[model samples]
Target: MGYEWLALAAAFLWAISSLISVTPARHLGPFSYSRWRMGCTAVMLTIMALIVGGWGSVSTAHVMPMVLSGLIGIFIGDTALFACMNRMGPRQAGLLFSCHAVFSAILGYWLFNETWHLAEIIGATLVFSGVVTAIFFGRKGSDNNDWEALHGKLAIGVALGLLAALCQALGGIIAKPVMQTDINPIAASAIRMITAFAAHSLFWASGAKLAKSKNPINRKIFSITALNGFLAMAVGMTLILYALQDGNVGMVALLSSTTPIMVLPLLWFITKQRPNHYAWFGAILAVIGTGLIVS
Candidate 1:
């Protein structure tokens, strides 16, 4: 039961890492930023695996799904998300991103035949609803990119957002059977990171496309992206695997949906202003949901 708390912690860690990534993502562009971040994460995970000597757990059965998880989740899902963010803005894109929980829950049931208890069902619903509410009416962006701005760009963003959700959900589902086994979550994360980083590297090397913003990858950019990669990829992803290793994949996925809600305090601290009171209620709802999920 206590292990469920790790999922909550993962939500916070991801929120922090996402906040830290804005500067680098803007500086290097999302694709470049993610590429560098993946490399840093791979290095971090590799070092940890070496120290623990847990690389021996990976087998032929675990390899393909883990690699495919990396490809679908990190490579395809994240790339689509970045594009959605560019077109729809973070808040708008996030509103759609919240749907990952629904996709995760459905896929977990359909693919793995995973079922939830009554408490788990109630808990996940509340958390998912709360996050959606919080994101919809939470922080007002500076540029005021309304979710209702349904232009061509917005349409594309919506489509990409859904696609990202599906990819992410499927990725998590794919990883569940492997993670539920005796494999170390840290090692699992390392394998996935290596897979994702290698794939992105090949894509870049192929010159299939170039970033919209061809900003030079400066040293500072590298440092920040590396930091972000450590938090978001190394820590956050490890906790995700750890959660899924012992808990219901659907429940873990929904719990991880709290990242945006977790961002409220950080926003308040950074801006010297409070989040919308509406967000506080949403937070309360999510906490109650957490209780039910863990009960």
Candidate 2:
């Protein structure tokens, strides 16, 4: 598959993994849950890298950038995202997370001299508009679903979500040059996971209150956390890195930002509640926009 398809695949995995992560993330708290996820994903990627002799592809030149990418992306971005999710639930959080596409596009233009065609720009706008429509107008006023519940200050949640988006964009941009090298994506992903895991380990060791778990760890929670790590970080992230190897950072980010659209159907299936017409309309817009982007 092309890089665009790879990015979309990553989006799909993230959509599934994000849904799986909600329960455990809420239980363990964002910081604790993020730490656990990084650790789990680190081990998984390290093993895969070793098994495939992918580590040999990594060079000293790639280390610093990958480390920076991990710290910015997984260490800060992911934790902020889950915290946003804790406050606003998946639907709203997903919309906010999708803002990374725009952030990445801007950053790519500024930092890497990347430019998108007019068609791509319009496509990106439509995708973003669809996200806004789906998130704001998709839910019914009468729907008192748990996913609709707001846990904390809406302002704080929105800030965190945007912060997550910016950091994620920065992370990808920082890694773009390294991805152009001969390094294996799996190896690059492993470095990122290990670096993030190490950062989380240090934070936990600092005995910060945020590092404490809100609920006791149970087998179910552990399983869910591990599964989320596998799909989201291990597989999903690897796919993104692979796409970044050849694709423009902005385009890859835009394609992957479709996670929100992908999540709607999964959300409907899990909640047994169909989305309103706005959701379908938004999905159509996003699909058409994606076609424009890749055409």
Candidate 3:
């Protein structure tokens, strides 16, 4: 399959993972879930690295950039995402997180001088506008102040999601320079994961007592976090890197940005919470935009 197709598949898997993660986030705090996700990803990637080449391909020059990318993308970006998910719910958080495409596109353009065609730009704009409309204006039978307060909270969540997106985009751009080196993608990813693990360890070490007191860990939370780590970080990110191997970074990011669209139907199926019509429209626009950009 083409990289675009692989990216789409990854997006679907990520969406499912996100939906599933929300369940655990409700019980275990976002930081707890993030710690589990990062830790598991580090372990899995380390095993893969050992089996593949034992870091023989990795160079000292590439190490720092990979570490920075991992810190920003996995440690910071993912933590912010989980926080937004907890505060804003899955739908709104997913929609806002979709802005990763825009941020990636901008960073790719600046970093690599990638340019977009008119059709691609128009398609992206349409998709983004549709998503914003759906998130802000598509509520049904809600005129209460509480509803307004929800919208306000969603706005803040969206802002944080955008910040995460920016970090992810910059991380990808920074990774590109490293990818151009002789380092293997798998090894590079492992290095990144190692750094992420270290950063997260520090975070947890400093906040362990507070986290334990605030949100006690339970069986269900651990199970969900483990599942999220496998699906979202390990499988999804591996597939993304594979896709990037065959395509432009911007196209890969755009295609992968459809994760929110994929999540909508899965949410409906799992939670029986169908997206509003506007959301459905936005999802369609996102798919179409991805096609235009990638093709």
- Whose TM-score is greatest here? 2
Ranking by TM-score: 2, 1, 3
Every model's TM-score: 0.91, 0.97, 0.87
Instruction: Indicate the TM-score of model 1.
Output: 0.91
**Alpha carbon lDDT of each predicted model:** 0.79, 0.92, 0.72
**Of candidates 3 and 2, the better by lDDT:** 2
Tens digits of per-residue lDDT for model 1, 1-295: 4657888898888778766766677666667777888989999999998889878887888889899999998888877776676566555566677688889988878887889888888888889878877777765442332322333565787898888878878888889999988887888899899999898898788785553335888888888888878887899888888888887777887888888788778756765657677778888888899889877
Candidate 1 deviates by what RMSD? 2.6
Q: Write the per-residue lDDT of candidate 2 for residues 1-295, one digit (tens) a residue.
A: 8998999999999999988988999999999999988998999999999999999998888999999999999899999999999988888898899999989998988988998889988998888888778877876651588886888899999999999999999999999999999999999999999999999999999999999999988999999999999999999999999999889999999999999999999999998888899988998888989899878
Poorest lDDT segment (10 consecutive residues) of candidate 3: 140-149
TM-score of 3: 0.87
Q: How do these models rank on lDDT, best leading?
A: 2, 1, 3
Q: Considering only N, C-alpha and C atoms within 3 Å, which residue pairs clash in candidate 3?
A: none
Candidate with more favorable, higher TM-score: 1 or 2? 2
| Model 2 pairs whose backbones collide | none
